[model samples]
Target: MVRNYKRKTDWTEKSKKAVKNGQTIRQAAHNYGINESSLWRAVRNVSAGKSLVSLSEASQSRIIFFLEEEAVLVEYLLKASRIGFPLDTSTLKSLAYDLAIRNSKRSWRTQKSAGKDWLKGFKSRHSQLSIRTPEPTSIARATAFNKTNVGPFFDKLKQLYEELSLTPERIYNVDETGGS
Candidate 1:
């Protein structure tokens, strides 16, 4: 009884080492060129609940927190960008992106939500955070503090009026005492 064998995708030395060192399947896939879902399955085949259970308590918690935050942030950014929000990625990874060929493989589904269905499961966690921070109309007018000409200068004037809205003389007093 001869059975046709599937050619094994050569796992790199680094991937083997990572697996030995108890790195997650996804980590091995990322560190090497292995498929994430495939790597997970191969690891699972070797030992049931072995790799998953070996995860350090701190590391597991960290990943859960990180994923929760990432899901929320992704939704926030996509919505904000659609309606035209600030284009700053000050907190971005600040690294160049590379593409990974995704595998259609999946892990054994535990008694838990999986696949695209789990994508927004933690979205309600982010709903607690207020994305729309309304700037005070007065202070928001004076965006550029150092500009000497036109736009910013005019804004300063507007700011001054709001500041002294209740004062009688209400002079901006922009002209500081001449440089002594």
Candidate 2:
């Protein structure tokens, strides 16, 4: 019951179903009510250029363990870690973070990752670009500035700022040295 360029969610669901049915992307789009370009985008987004995930021994074991766990904490931790949440914290800390993160927005940037299949195919056939390396980028400089070194620089600045002042103890430093 799909119509062309209808609701986005409807399109996605129909597209996903069509793909699952072993239809080629163009064929899938044709039957499921979308254009070739739209179908390509959906397929590319889900597959991420490489083949779809298949169940393997390791995957099966992981699934079994995840299902058998007393709490879903391990599964929760795994999902959280993938999205850049801290999973190494103590139980209480983990719980706190888990609770706090419920309202945080999910990052949509993963789709824009270079491995998208449509992008890969398009670039390969037309632009001759690979996901790992696009066009020629800037050559690496031997002494490129690293943002990671900025913390120490700021600490030194704080020291310098404090040193130039008459009172050091009274100076309220907002940042703790090497703040975690």
Candidate 3:
């Protein structure tokens, strides 16, 4: 079951605006309808260069990695995915450990690898990416299907179709022979 709640104010945005205008945390809290303590914390974080929006909206649960570090990891993951070399969870954790070591994140140095909780947070933060079971196929088979055969076939088929001025609605490509 899902519960929907209406927000009375975007306290973060209001707090930021108030701080920028030289209002005290207490004044900002009263003006923006945010808890005084939470607004004070938000002011402190904002003073430290963390965005109020992210502070307010992001999950309050413990996070092992910093935002910039996680962003870099996400970039690597996206690039790997584009190159058809997406990492599984264990591999991603290992990579994250390596990243932490390279970036000299002192807290993470004590751990062997990022925990399952960290992985869950990372996944939730990145909604566009999904964990999927890979199809059962050899690397050689997949390479051949994608690089050796499929590309040339599509290129030639496209050339011939354009030469014949085939209408998209009427034209269909179907394999005539089932796999032996």
Q: What are the lDDT scores of the predictions, listed in order?
A: 0.47, 0.47, 0.73
Q: Per-prediction TM-score, please?
A: 0.21, 0.23, 0.46
Predictions ranked by lDDT, top down? 3, 2, 1
lDDT of 2 by residue, 127-170 (tens): 32111322333556433446765678978978888788746555
State the lDDT of candidate 3 residue by residue for 1-180, as single tens digits: 112256666768768788789998788788777789887777778779886554335544445578888889889987887676767888888898898778876545666788777777677779977655455788877777756568888899899889998877866435532111
In model 1, the worst 10-residue window by lDDT is: 93-102
Q: What is the lDDT of residue 121 in candidate 3?
A: 69
Error of 2 at 150 (Å): 75
Error of 1 at 112 (Å): 48
Better of 1 and 2 by TM-score: 2
lDDT of 3 at 33: 72
Give the clash total for candidate 2.
0
